[model samples]
Target chain A: MSDIKILQFAPFESFVSPTFWHKLAELKLDYDRLSDTKRSIFGYYTNRKASGCLLEVDYSAYNSEAQVPKFSHVAHGNIYNKNTIEEFKALDKTALLADEGKQLLDDMRSGRALSDASLLTRFFVLSFADLKCHSYYYWFAFPCPLTPALELLSPATKLKEIPNNGNYVEAISVLPAHAQNFFILHVNEQEKVCEALSLTAALSDFDEERAQHYIYCFADPSEYENPAWLMRNYVALLLQKCPTLIGKSLKFLGLRYDQQMHLDNSLIWEVRQAEACNYEHVQFVGWEANRNGKMGPRMANMRDSMDPAKLAENSV
Target chain B: MHIPNESKFRETGVLTPEEFVAAGDHLVHHCPTWQWAAGDESKTKTYLPKDKQFLITRNVACYRRCKQMEYVGEETLVEEESGDGGWVETHQLNDDGTSQLDDKICELTLDESKDEMFTIENGKRSPLRVVTTDDDNEDDDEAIDMDTFEESGMLELVDPAVATTTRKQDIETNPSNLASVVNASETTNSADSVLRTRTYDLHITYDKYYQTPRLWVVGYDEQRKPLTVEQMYEDVSQDHAKKTVTMESHPHLPGPNMASVHPCRHADIMKKIIQTVEEGGGQLGVHLYLIIFLKFVQTVIPTIEYDFTQNFNMS
Candidate 1:
């Protein structure tokens, strides 16, 4: 950086990128706008080194190589997206008696990678499940204490149906800035954009200039007590500040200086028990082109049989 | 992949010094390229090239047109404003005297090495000579201590053998070579105090349909932000200042390319000069062409404290 007296060209103008603007809009929505919103988190990525910001879910905690009785619902188990990790763990033992379930159980116990059907079935269930509905608990025999049973029953809502074999049941692999690690968030482009926009809209009040300045900084709501709810605000602030972030889009969204987990927004979920969630390291597992000229099955990271000639050469 | 070479001047023989001067005067009176510095110095704020320096005006890309907002980091700001008083600082070194190893990485890092190499090749042709100071007697005395810290006095160029041979050939072929003109000035200066006129190198060439005048700069003063068209036209004639000439940014040359412009009528004047030289079956090499251009430019910019000569090889 010697006095750069000599330049090839004279600078003409300075401009901002569209991604920065989108981030600004999102940050404003997250800071002073949206709360308890349906579209809470937009984009997510895993940081192996605990570069804390906001944690949506720590799948790694639940499923790691070091954990006993390795947990891999997506790669080995019968649990779908609709089934929470808690519900998946709590599945009835009787369900495993069926032939397909038995085969899945055998595969899981044998440490064999589950077929694509198992993973897709789970995703299909989660994708189709009506997450927006609320189930009310009745106090009396099938009814509220003060209301008639028939009156308590409300009009049935219509549920959209889709062929599981249709074009919808597709898994997308997300590669973050860290090349070694990736996340398999179950959603498509439309869902991601909608969630990103909603997050940005939450911080719409903040001016663009200020939004550009503090978009990467975590949102601090000291009064909120619940970690889950607090976690949502963190995600909201993060998503708004960095709308383009699939992972590491905000280059400066690094770990905070303070190690206090109570105030830190980076940690999404606390991994309290090892036995509760079984985790396994995936070598390679995703949809690949099959023999039938269609995307089929989950393939785990398995290396080919080593060649004798190559082994001999390595030994030399 | 390539266009065929065709230059009318190459077909004609080189122009003599007398014919070059006559052609230069024709363009100055009829088709001037410079304009007078408008109003006071503060109002214009254009860099008035002192002795031994010249303004090189050219159109460059506008930074204001960028739509994307960029956060210029501290590192970037420091690099941008490192030069003295914001006149982007660059040094003119004698040939083959750079810390080449230090810049090797920057050169290999990007594909911009072609232009970088070209600038180096260009630097080989005209190694910058010693720089002269315009400071008053008192300022010079005070600058003695400062001189030790700074690069003091004129840095002489190590002249190459090839340049001497070329100069001899130019003198032998053309009767009105710049060396003779410089000698004439030298003789006149000996009679009185040294004629300390600043020398500038002019470049007149066709760019597409237009001819442009690009002056070679040696250095600039403090606070010289002469990148814009308005800030560069202070030394031009008043009438010619209104003429629209785009200031282009040179990709490689740093301080030397400042306050320069690509005037529209440059090609027209150049064509006229070529025609004048070609009439006598005379050729036009770079040296003779420069001699002619300065002859006309001197009258147009009479008030400016500068002179034009081909004492050193210009890129």
Candidate 2:
């Protein structure tokens, strides 16, 4: 059986500071969090509904051919300034799709293809991170790719997400009309697990300077309370809350509670003060970066996890 | 010297271990060394002094001084020779306007925090920068870079946006021109989903010149599962492409809510999902069985439209 226990954020707070990084590798965990929200896991899917060109046909291969714009290849601005990326919004998709959807669009204008932007817009492209975020978002989608199969299923155009697609239909974008929206509950450790082990290395790159400006941009009243401290704390709290972050568990964050309300043991584990200097580098950080996909092997980078039995070892 | 609490004294730019020792020694050599005498209890430091008895505190840096300094609760008057050669006594007041006896140096002044002077650590460097990376640096996980002149060769640029911890400049500076350096930063606006599009298709044209239809596995997900692919064609909603079916008693399938997956066009779709996998990016499968199956289905099915969506509730 895989380790149901996930890594949490609470105990490892000290690792962010240089003083405790050396001790991080020594941490380990055997069980998961107690709540449904906090199980730790690393999941990957073959995204099919993504709307852009696959990397195979990207600019790398087509040097002399027509330079068509792709959604994934389209440039945009960041949240800080719209002054940048101002022009990308108005790109005409007609030119790029001329080769693929040209006949279809012309037919639509000539009563051939439907005028509905949704119909002409078939491919849905998004990155893995975006896909993960979209998992919780709502969208409108049609039932069938075939108008007849769809009409047979529903006379009028019905837009909604449905789940007949098996797990292997991985890595492709579905029609927007068929996109599903639901929240995967994560609490405790699951809420805080890095989508990949690479995230831990990214966490090290986060300094108070960048935290103040970009990543954890302040100014929102809800985030006024020690933005740095709050984010770190919530990350820990949420890690303890979600379970999907852990491998997969029904009870979130592996809660081990006593009858009197005191937790007999914690569900999440964190490696603070990694004894091995490897925790800060890209190799250690990029443990999964270049992999086509997959967390790869845990033993490659996973040094330690917290154990609920060692609650007494806390500094308090 | 007796540092005031009004401002945090940030000793900065601490160098090597040797420098730290030298700095401590310098402070001891320059300042007036006071013995720990049993004077007025509160005003004096009490301790066993050796032959070369130092100051009132073991910490060389944290101490008070004055020329024949008297521990008066009011303030310490430092007597020093002015440039004009007259003896001038200066009183250093505490934050609350109350003056206290601190330290007196032979030739010194306040605001002495030099960049090179302080040895306090900055928040950036870890006080314990243990070897986080192995010295071997035998980067095995990174891809084995393919040589140039390989089929249709061009360097694949890794987008910084994929970086989990992107800096503000990365997200802002040239977001619109992220991958398409050809596109200028000034050529875009909001509501654009192109940059927002996450999929990248590697379309290889199938021509008679090709002895065999070549297929290449590009990327996968975190699980190393193959990414979904399809026979690129018209959208599902077209008239000729539309396959109508009768509004028969329908077997309701799940939605994104239950399985919470890509709703449609997914390889998981009931009719073509198997063909999608069987083909597996190979033209053989798409051409051999999938295309045949699709063509057959289109020819036979007389499609109909019905609304069974409201027939059930979400789980």
Q: Best-fitting candidate, measured by lDDT?
A: 1
lDDT of 2 by residue, A189-306 (tens): 3233212111222233433322211111100001011111111222222122221222211111112212232222212212121121111111101111111222111111111112
Native contacts retained, all candidates in order: 0.00, 0.00
Determine which window of 10 residues in candidate 2 chain B has minimal summed lDDT: B250-259
DockQ of each: 0.01, 0.01
Per-prediction interface RMSD? 39.4, 27.7
lDDT, candidate 1, B55-164, per-residue tens: 22211112110000012235434654453222112212212345452243223222221335323522432211111112234333423322222211111211110001
List, in order, the clash count of every candidate structure: 72, 154
Off by more than 4 A, model 2? A1-37, A45-316, B1-234, B240-288, B294-315
